[model samples]
Target: MRVDLFDFELPPERIALRPVRPRDSARMLVVEGGAAPFADRRVSDLPSLLRAGDVLVFNDTRVIPAQLEGRRGEASIGATLHKRIDLRRWQAFVRNAKRLKPGDRIDFPQGVTAIAEERHADGSFTLAFGGEEPVEVLLERAGTMPLPPYIAGKRPTDAQDREDYQTMFAREDGAVAAPTAALHFTPELLAALAEAGIASETLTLHVGAGTFLPVKAEDTEAHAMHSEWGRIDAATADRLNAARAAGGRVIAVGTTSLRLLESAAGEDKVIRPFEGDTAIFITPGYRFRAIDGLMTNFHLPKSTLFMLVSALMGLERMQAAYAHAIANEYRFYSYGDSSLLIP
Candidate 1:
């Protein structure tokens, strides 16, 4: 499909500068099958919407403070590490690329330095840090949360983002972006789901910084997906299969979780424990596996995520749903209102 087909006009004011006062208080738009528009509701109403024995799969990868600012002599560079290639090597996006020559040293505030080793065709760089220890340790000491680009002005990382960008079940650290659908759940909400007999399971998909990058290609098929490390352990896989055997629906909490589960499914759509990198791109016409329903945040127009939802609910229906969300004054993008795709 042409990438332009996903384009839509969104008012700048609709961008959610801050999350809702109570996270679960955000609005949720429900789109079932190839249905008419959407039925609007609040996120807190999720428990009532789901049936007993339904398995809600969540991405439990924690967001890291991966945005690092550094300099090469008098030149400034904005650095964001997307993934760890190894213990000492990382793939990163570096701004002011022309100012830094290969082998030039870039220093961070918390005593981290990156030596630019090579540049990729997409303008990102391969960086190698000196010294023997792992880079994860250095990152924990030096980096700041990689906030979405829409957030304006210079600001320090504060108490709120530290909590808001993370999910209640977040455990492993790697993702630069949060699996936003998981953000709607609070400890209280999780308990409520449990009491209601809704089973919860977790998988890890360290969301990559590529989620923020725009689709530069004119055709959807031409767009290359950025691979992110993910895993569904053996135990979680077993429980998910058991839930399905009992006639339970598998509800993915976000596109991240959906992508990981779909990537790990076998021919019969049964999920298996998987540990690897995936660059799976779900566009319209793609067949789904292991996801019966999805709870997710609103997405940007012309984004890969928009295409993922379009794949689930059909393009026209998704367009109408997005239009309804906009007309109804629902917030858009990360840290925004959510939607449930029953289809």
Candidate 2:
């Protein structure tokens, strides 16, 4: 399919710069399968919207401050770590690629520094940190939250983004980006879900900076998705299968979770233990295996995420739904409003 088919006009003001206060107060647009009318609701209404025995799978991968600004011999350089290659080495996208070469040391704040090692064909570099201290500690001292360019381009990142970008379920540390759909969940909403008997589980998918990359491909078939690490243990997979066997629906809290779940499921639709990288590029005509529904934030035009949703529903359905969202003033992108897609 042509990538242009997914394109839509979005007013700049509709892009969200920050999350709403209390988290759950953010509006949610419920889009059902087929020709059902779109329903406007709040994130807090999830407990009532969902039935008992339905499970909401959340991504527990924590966002690391992967954005770094440094200098090499007076030449300014910017880097966003994309994936972990080793305990001390990472593959990163560089801003000043022309100025960097193999073996050049970039000096960051707090004496934290890294050496540019091998450069990839895509112009990314292998960054190896220089220190005995854990790389996490080095990042904490010198790195800042990796906000999506849509929001960061409008305003500077601050201390507020540190907490706002993270979800309550964040634990495992590896992701460069937060599973923004989960950002709308709060303790109060969890309590309500528990009281309502709507079960929730967690999986891990270390979201990379590739999520923010634009689809420059003219056709959807030409687009290649960057891999991201994810995991689903035996116990969790067994539980999810058991829930489904009992006629319960498995709802993914974010596309990261849905992608990971689909990666773990078999052709028979049984989820199994999985641990590795997944570069699943979900587009229209793809068959969903593990998840029954999805709760995610609004996505960018012509993005892989929009393609995924279009697959779950249909191309025409998603196009119309997005039109309604934009017309209704629903916030867009990470740190934006939520949507519950039931297809």
Specify the highest-TM-score model's number: 2
Off by over 4 Å in 1: 152-159
TM-score of every candidate relative to the true structure: 0.96, 0.99
Candidates' lDDT values, in order?
0.89, 0.95
Looking at model 1, residue 238 earns an lDDT score of 91
Q: After superposition, how far is residue 53 of candidate 1 from its true place, in Å?
A: 1.0
Please give the TM-score that candidate 2 achieves against the real structure: 0.99
Q: Name model 2 segments beyond 4 Å from true.
A: none
lDDT of 1 by residue, 1-343 (tens): 9999999999887888778968789999998985455789998888899999998999989998888888889999888899879878888988898897778889887678889988888888888987776777777788778888876343556757878888888899889899988888887788889988999999999999999999999999899999999999999999999999999999999999999999999879889999999999999999987889999988998999999999999898889899999999999877899999988
